[model samples]
Target chain A: MKVAVVKYNAGNVQSVIYALQRLGVNPLHTEDQQEIRTADKVIFPGQGEASSAMDYLRSKGLDQVLTSLTQPFLGICIGLQLMCRHSEEGDTDCLGIFDLEVKRFKVHQHGFKVPHMGWNRLETDNSQLFQAVENPFMYYVHSYYAEVGIETTGITDYILPFSGALQKDNYYAVQAHPEKSSDAGQTILTNFLNI
Target chain B: MLTKRIIPCLDIKNGRTVKGINFVSLVDAGDPVEQAAIYSDAGADELVFLDITATLENRKTLVELVRKVASKINIPFTVGGGISQKEHVSELLNAGADKVSVNSAAVRDPQLIDRLAASFGSQCIVVAIDSRYIEGHDIVHTHGGSRPTELETMAWAQEVERRGAGEILLTSMDHDGTKKGFACDLTRKMSTTLTIPVIASGGGGSAAHFEEVFNGGKADAALAASIFHFHEVDIMDLKKELQAANIPMRI
Candidate 1:
């Protein structure tokens, strides 16, 4: 399969590319609209600020290209947040693919840490992306999360219950890093590839 | 629920592991990439590679090692040691390291934390604090805990957090290498004081020490080098023990 990873000014795209290579798929890492549009699948993976990332996307005209794509697209971490309607980080607007708002974790108590940085179990629905995975734990490192909504397919509890995985038609997004999530995450990526 | 993390730290010198590791599955124990893969497959939540390469020429080797490890290992890993500049962090992150830990450099220039956090998001910035209790005070130390600093341990940790550090890696010099146990009191103080997750490093001898650090120390995660490198405590077996003790582990 010809997979195109939407690249911008974000970090950790190399790891995504490596993960796909481990799965026997050499994904093309590109921000070019034509390459991304023509690919069989597109993976939007990143780790960076929302406003700066949105700015880069607009500068490259990827925002429009990404929103208009009809192929199966996967968004990871910041990619998932940027796919939402808005983000609390930098108070920037995002692509309205999921129709959800990304809110920062409020540390009301002492034990509740921001950037919920560790492994957490997922409460998943019947989404095809989670076909064989059963409430598996995934690696998470983020302060802001997409609030659980209609597109929500998986929920993970930290300070509050947030959307772990979201699916709406062809657009699929996950708040955690599936590339670094070990076996269960590899399964999710494989499922996405097969889709 | 967010589970407690078990991190196996590897010290690297010129792109090779410094300490000898006794993993039967590993062909070359000095290979950080192979060791990291073993840890990941054995249920380690994350891995940390502290590049101790002294010469500037060997720095390229660290980046290459990071690239190799990121390609081979599936779990998240952090690359630390002598990382002071934004350019250095940019290179390592571009090479595919999930997080980068800053130690003595962060202590030298406090604003470095802010600059790094602004340039690269806070999620990738980890401030490693090495402290030793001296005359009823927890004082921060630099250069592998050999040089003493004026900053207090708790105060420095809080400062880094306020300056936008995503996490704190606290290492107690007194407990380290003792093999008695982790500094539960100091770790608990940092964990309760800061809103960021604390990874307690130092004296981790047995699985019970991990349970103590997680429950009593209130550390979000625990890191150890010798005990893991020497095979005194197996990662999987240690995690099972922690799980049996009602401590949440990946296993």
Candidate 2:
């Protein structure tokens, strides 16, 4: 399978490469429009500030290229935040693939941390992603979460039932890091590949 | 609820796993690549590999080791020891490290933290503090815990957070290999003082010790090496015990 990992001014794409390699596929990491356009599966994984990333994307004109793709695309972490309508992170607008607004996790909530790091299970029932996957805990590392909306496929509760995974048409994005999330996370990747 | 993380740290020297008692008397433990895969499958939330290599050739060997380990494990991986610049971090990240920790260098040049956070984002930069409590005060020590810096522990943590560090890997030199327990007081102080996650490292002996650090220490995550490296404690069993104690663990 021809897989193209979207390359941008984001951190931690090496883990994505390792994730794909474990599944017996060596994906091509690229920023070229043609390489991303002609892939069987595209993964938009990132770990960085949304505002600066959006700036880089606009500079390289990847925003249009990402939104125009028809292939099965997966967005992870900052990638999901950037696919929304707008983010409160830096008052920056996103690609609008999913009509949802991203909000920061509220502070002063007793003793809980802000970034919501580490692993948590998915209280979701989507067969396409969770099929045959018994344990559903996946790694998450973010301060902002997309509010659960109509197209929400996976839901997790930190302060509220936020959208852990969103699916609309050909675009599917997850707030969790499947690459670093162990066995169940790999299963989610396999399910996406099968689709 | 966010689950508490149990991380097993590997002290690597020249591509081999080594262990020590209170930072001395190094002994060969096993293969790092094999140990990493075993820990991941056995339910370790994350893994840290501290490259204690001295020569440039050994540093190159560590990179190859990281590549081999990343290909097998499916969890968060953090690499530390002798990381001095943004270029070193980039090389490790390019070799499949999820996070790169800067210790002595960060203490020597505090501006290195800002530069790394700017280039790789705060989420990618981790400021590791090796601290020793003495004279009724906690003092920060760098240079493999042999030298003391003028900075205090709490003040350094505040500064690291202010300079945009994603996390702080706080290792208590006094309690590191003693395995009595984590420095609960220090861990709680740092966790409450900082907005970012605090990974409590050193002096993890038993499952109850993990409980003490997570509950009394208020640590976001607890890390240990000796107990995990010698099979004295299993990660799964430790999680079960912590879960039964009403601590939220990723089981």
Give candidates' CA RMSD values in order: 1.2, 3.0
How far off is residue A181 in model 1, in Å? 0.5
Q: Write the per-residue lDDT of candidate 2 for residues B1-251, one digit (tens) a residue.
A: 78999999988888888774232122333678777877888899999998887467777888888888888888988899898878788888888888889989988899999999888877767889999998988999988899998989999999998898999999999999898999999999999878888999989999989999999999989998878767789899999999999998888
Stretches of model 2 off by over 4 angstroms after superposition:
B20-29
DockQ of 1: 0.83
Local lDDT at B116 for model 1: 94
The pairs that clash in candidate 2 are none
Chain B of candidate 2 vs. true chain B, TM: 0.94
User: Highest DockQ: which candidate?
Assistant: 1
Number of backbone-clashing residue pairs for each candidate, in the order shown: 0, 0
| Residue range B8-32, candidate 1, lDDT tens digits | 9999999999989987778998998
Single out the weakest 10-residue window by summed lDDT for candidate 2 chain A: A107-116
In angstroms, give how far residue B20 of model 1 lies from its true place: 1.1
